[model samples]
Target chain A: GIQVEQSPPDLILQEGANSTLRCNFSDSVNNLQWFHQNPWGQLINLFYIPSGTKQNGRLSATTVATERYSLLYISSSQTTDSGVYFCAVDTQEGGAQKLVFGQGTRLTINP
Target chain B: GAGVSQSPRYKVAKRGQDVALRCDPISGHVSLFWYQQALGQGPEFLTYFQNEAQLDKSGLPSDRFFAERPEGSVSTLKIQRTQQEDSAVYLCASSLGGRGRRETQYFGPGTRLLVL
Candidate 1:
């Protein structure tokens, strides 16, 4: 099984600030995704970057497959961004697409 | 078009009772999956279905758990003889394609189960 570890387990910052979250995997992965779990517990898809970089609005993500790690960047964060951000990966063993998720980074932005 | 939808947003069952949670995935999606998330922890895979066939259930915690996607579009996760340890948020996700594809999984709101 592959291990996924996220850094800065807990983060708090003032609104309009920027932040970065990192995820490190123990092995190679075929699929990687980022999600934001809101206060109501809905897992909102942020990005699906198995490799390379992508940006959407104030959120962006970059995955270095060879390095076995990924980064999520949030610029000009707002108070509504307070929640847990998760990084998940799929190893596709035996053609199975089960996701192994990291413990998540709890982010809090104060207005 | 809609994302994954789940039923009984919250549930409470006494020990030894049985409960069933339902998930309706996005239309035309071929891959459905079930996961369990404990308090303050990441979600763990439980089972996966490619159409009506269940390919893998290795992540199921015990024999008391069962899942089925008979029609290939909807899925149900059933837990029998529940214990206190079974309390957690059960999440359902679906992707557009089958195994080996790089499709993004869309998740439902999840059903929170509390076993007393």
Candidate 2:
């Protein structure tokens, strides 16, 4: 079993602020994804970066496979971005894409 | 294309009752997953299905929990003899499948369950 730990478990900021959330895993994994769980309990896919770096709009993610960690950067955050950010990973062995999620970083952006 | 959808956005059941939750994955997607999310926590894996075959169910909390995807598209998770501890949000996800690196797993708005 791989362990995923997220830093800054809780964050609060004003609108237009920037924040960085981190995720560290214990073992090598081929399936690492970033997700945003909205207030309605919908887990939206933010990024699927097992390694390397990717950017979408104001959200960006970078994963260092060798270091077994990933980071999600929220730039110019908005009130709509307030929610729980999760990092999930599944091993290359026999996990069969079953993702194990971290506890998550709870972000609150006040308007 | 429509994203994943779940029925009965919320459910309330008496302690000894049985509840079944349904999930409809994205069309043409080959992989589906079920997870349990407790309050203020991330989702924990419960099961995985590749089409109609369940590949992993080690995360199931107990025998009271069961899931099936007989047609390889829709899935149902059933919980029998529910207890207060069984209350939580059940999430379903789907992804395009193959080997090696894979695509993102699109998730449905989960079903919230409450037992009393």
Candidate 3:
């Protein structure tokens, strides 16, 4: 019951440009977050990593997690960062906190 | 109410009627979740509570969907006769448990149901 794959489902950047979004998971994880469903949907919570690097200004994230993959970096982007950018996981490693989302990465910031 | 606050943000039933969605966590939260978003995907576990017990509803998809959190804060998700695929958008998360199983949930700003 663990499968999450999000990768450039759709993206269009311009304002300041700089993007790299990806998240892949299939197993081994107690939790892993990184959401931002703005545009009035408000599910914001940028990074919980669940493994490695993390930054919260220019927006950065990196979770190797033994190759499970996870990388989100939006450098100088603006335009409110557009919308949808989620990558959740909770492979039940620790149980209780079920989450397994990943059909996002629809960012469009053209200003 | 710093976060996790959901309510009648939007609801328009008709199919079979009987709907009740509400959640307000984030005040000494002790685990509380219920998600089901279906417009572009993402957000799908249907239930789980620790305070008022409700272990997990196993994603609840049938039985007309139902959830409650009695005296463990505030939570309710009842979708009786409703149909039309139950529409979409209906999230409500909360964490900060005893700091064990895992933390950081906090999500709310959803509840856009439309079954007609």
Among the numbered candidates, top DockQ falls to 1
lDDT of 2 by residue, A66-100 (tens): 99999999999999999999999988564478888
What is model 2's DockQ versus the real complex?
Answer: 0.67
Q: Please list the residue runs of candidate 1 whose C-alpha ends up more than 4 Å from where it truly belongs after superposition.
A: none
Number of backbone collisions per candidate: 0, 0, 0
How close is candidate 2 at the interface, in terms of C-alpha RMSD after superposing the true interface residues?
2.0
Lowest lDDT block of 10, candidate 2 chain B:
B95-104
Predicted candidate 1 versus true structure: per-residue lDDT over A55-95, tens digit per residue: 99999999999999999999999999999999999998558
Q: Can you tell me the DockQ of model 1?
A: 0.81
lDDT of 1 by residue, B4-107 (tens): 99999999999999999999999999999999999999999999999999999999999999999999998999999999999999999999999878789999
Tell me each candidate's TM-score: 0.99, 0.97, 0.34
lDDT of 2 by residue, B1-116 (tens): 59999988999999999999999999998999999999998899899898899988999999999999999999999999999999999999998884333678999999999999
Which residue pairs collide, candidate 3?
none
* Highest-scoring model, TM-score: 1
Which 10-residue window in model 3 chain B sums to the lowest lDDT?
Answer: B95-104
lDDT of 3 at B57: 91
